[model samples]
Target: MKIGIISDSHDNIDAIAKAVEILNNSNVDLTIHLGDIVSPFCFDWFKKLRSDFLGVFGNNDGEVLFLDKKSEGVLHKPPFEVEIDRKEFILMHEPFGIEKLKTQYDYVLYGHLHKVDIRKTDRGCIINPGELCGCLTKKRTMVILNTTDNQTQLITV
Candidate 1:
């Protein structure tokens, strides 16, 4: 199964649209947003995704109720745990205690610093797909993970 990962979009509709196109074309089985979506209106782009999607709330996501509604209840508070393709995964908006969490799940994914971070551990991987908004790094990025082999491709969208 292929999983699409993105974070810190910061209301960049263009970038988000591009990322969604890429993910859709890539035929990802699931798409995970690491938050910082900023506003509910961004759903205009997110709704275009062709695969199943979910997300966690970032610090900047103030309209929690609307975000949840827009996401159709797929958006949740940070540090959410999910099992996909028989792999245990933890999703959070902030990279807090990731080292500790890594030991417990097959993947510890987070966003917040607006930087790309990918670390392979003995058990699994720790990944942050970076800022889709290109606000801090001046580069829009995302990730595609193959669950069968645990391989990841970092993509610039």
Candidate 2:
């Protein structure tokens, strides 16, 4: 299965739209938003996605209840875990929470710092899809992970 990962979108509708287009073109089985989605309006665009979507709340996310109500299918509370294709995946909005994990997962995903980072540890693969907002870094990016082989490709939007 292929999974699309995105984060730090900070309400850049155009960038989000572009990323969604790319993910759709790639035919990802699932899309995970690490956080900093910022606004409910921005998430509306995600409704157009063909793949399944899930997200965690970031520090910047406001109106939590409203966002949850509007994005019932997409939002997942932080530090959550799910098994897909027999691989366990953990999702969080901040990297710090990952350090406190007691169990190992096949993939650990988080977003906070607006930088693209991919690394492997004895435990599993760690990925941050970077800033989709392009506000601080001035570059928009995301990543697609091939779960079958645990390989990933970074894409700039």
Highest TM-score model number: 1
- Model 1: per-residue lDDT, tens digit, 1-157? 9999999999998999899999999999999999999999999889999999988999999999999998999998988999999999999998899888988999999999999999998777999999999999999999999989989999999
Residue-level lDDT for 140 in candidate 2: 95
Per-residue CA lDDT of model 2 for 1-157, tens digit only, reads 9999999998889998999899999999999999888888886799888999988989898878888888885687788888878988888888865555524787889899999989875656889989998998898989999988888999999
* Model number with the top lDDT: 1
lDDT against the true structure, each candidate: 0.94, 0.87
List per-candidate RMSD values in Å: 0.6, 1.6
- For each candidate, what TM-score against the reference? 0.98, 0.93
